[model samples]
Target chain A: MTVNELIEKCGFNAVSLPEPEREINGCYIGDLLSWVMGRAEADNVWITIMSNINIIAVATLADVCCIILAEGVTVDDEIVKLAGEKGVNILLSDKKTYETAVAVYEAI
Target chain B: MSESLTFHYDVDGEDFTSAGQASVQVKKNLRRLGIAPDIIRQVSIAMYEGEINMVIHAGGGEADVIVSEDKIDIILADHGPGIADIELAMQEGYSTAPDSVRSLGFGAGMGLPNMKRYMDEMTIDSTVGVGTTIKMTVYLNR
Candidate 1:
């Protein structure tokens, strides 16, 4: 399913939807940026609690379809702006990381 | 054969938030040069890891990317305290980064290993109290 479809089905708040139509092929759950960088496949929806700027670089480098900031972890306006500028899709979920993964699993 | 292209950037150690800027820029340059997506990903990831290591442990460094017809070379050099044990450092899950870096979602001790995992060849030259230099190459035909 595309990121837009997943967002609607999972009830996620769109933070940056530059590539809302980007397809989601899989899901990866991790908080360690380096580990996520190496393991997360392209087009995967990365679920994490980390909201630093490095997350933006990781998402871009990994070519992830979108990032779901789980556990209600919110980023500042600067991060959202960077995500938009870099063409990285981001969604915010009130659920925890596992729940976010399950939601993505069911939606995709 | 045509001449190789090189890109250079100085990593700013003061800002952890901007660690991977060079890798991001390198990714864009490779994309513009029509490098394959997979190759670009490898180069970007390897360089990104190295860049992060520089900022976290070495107080920043210099990074260079040399792109040629058959391969790409990435070199990272830093003047911070060098790794006393290269073997230990190469081992996965062995890192000397402080708690502050770990809290930022890094310092899982996978930087060098990840760099090796992505590059075709990796080498390190480090001296304690002096500096460290890492050179990695990724072949295009691979």
Candidate 2:
């Protein structure tokens, strides 16, 4: 399923969707920015508890289709603004990382 | 002909949130240079890991990315405390970063390993308490 479908069906909130319809070909769960950068395949839906501004750069650099922040972590205003500015899809989920990863996998 | 170009940036150590900015800019510059997407990805990922390491461990550093027809050269130099054990640090699950850094979703001992993973060639020059210099090359023609 597309990112938008994941948002719609999986109950994920699209906090800043620059690419709602982006195709998520895989799912990678990692909090280490560098680890994700090195391992996560392009167009993967990256799930993490990290809600820092650096995430935007990682998502953009890794070419991840979307960033799903699990555990309802909320970043500051500047980070959210930067997310929109960078044109990256940022989603929020109340579920834990494992649940979110499974949901994303099953959704797509 | 497009001659080789070089871009430099001073990574700020105080701001962990902005650690990857240099890598992001390098990625964009490489994209405009008409490099293949895969090549750009490798270069950016390796450099991004280097930039993060500079901030989290070395209190920031200087990054120079030289783009040429044959390769992309990334030189990261810092004056902060250097690696005490290169072989140990290169291990995939060994990290020296503080617990505070770990809370930020990094410091999982993957920085150096990731850098090497994404680059075609990598070398480390470091001295304890003096500084560290890492040079990585991604060959475009390889």
Candidate 3:
């Protein structure tokens, strides 16, 4: 499913979107950026509590389909701006990372 | 054949927020050079991991990426405290990064192993009190 479809159905707080229509092909749950970079498949929906700006770099380098910041993590203003500029989609969720991952799995 | 090009970046260790900037720029440069997606992915991933390791452990470092016809060479150099145990550090689940780093979505003990996994060849030169230097290569044609 596309990013917007997940946001609409899953009820996430849509934060920033460079491409809402980008398709998610898989799901990976991890907090370590390097591990995610190595294991997360391209076009996968990355669910994490990390709201830092570096996450944007990981998302772009790893070709992640989108990022779901879970558990009410607040995002930095710079992160939001960079995400928009990088054309990376970031979704905010109050749910735990696992719960959000499950919702993403069921959505697709 | 295209001439080899080298890009240099100074990784800032004091700011965790800016750790991966070098790798991101390298990715963009490679894209402009028309490097293949898969090859770029390999080089960037390995280089990114190395960059993170330098920031987390070495307090910042220097990264140079040399793009050539058959391969891309990444040389990461840092003057921080060196790794005492290369084999142990290379283990997938061993890490010395503080818990705070874990909260930032890193230091899960996967940095070095991940770098090794993505590169075609990896070599580590580390001394206990001096520092560490890692050289890794990703072959374009491989």
Residue-level lDDT for A99 in candidate 2? 86
Which wins on TM-score, candidate 1 or candidate 3? 1
Docking class of 1: high
In model 1, which regions exceed 4 Å deviation?
Answer: none
lDDT of 2 by residue, A30-102 (tens): 8887789878999999998888778898899899999988998877778888988888998889998888888
lDDT of 1 by residue, B1-142 (tens): 3789999999998999988899999999999999999999999999999999999888999999999999999999999999999999999999999999999999999999999998999999999999999999999976
Off by over 4 Å in 3: none
| Among all candidates shown, the one with the greatest lDDT | 1
User: Model 2: DockQ against the native?
Assistant: 0.78
Candidate 2 chain B minimal-lDDT segment of 10 residues: B1-10
Could you arrange the candidates by lDDT from highest to lowest?
A: 1, 3, 2
State the lDDT at A43 in candidate 3.
90
Each candidate: RMSD:
1.0, 1.6, 1.6
Give the Å shift of residue B17 in candidate 3.
0.5
Two-chain DockQ for each candidate model: 0.87, 0.78, 0.77
RMSD after Cα superposition, model 3: 1.6
> By the TM-score metric, which is better: model 1 or model 2?
1
lDDT of each: 0.93, 0.88, 0.88
Instruction: Give one digit per residue, the lDDT tens place, for model 2 in B1-142.
Output: 2588999999999998778889889988988988999888888888888888888888899999998778889999999899898999999989988999888778888888988988889999999989999999988866
TM-score of 1: 0.98
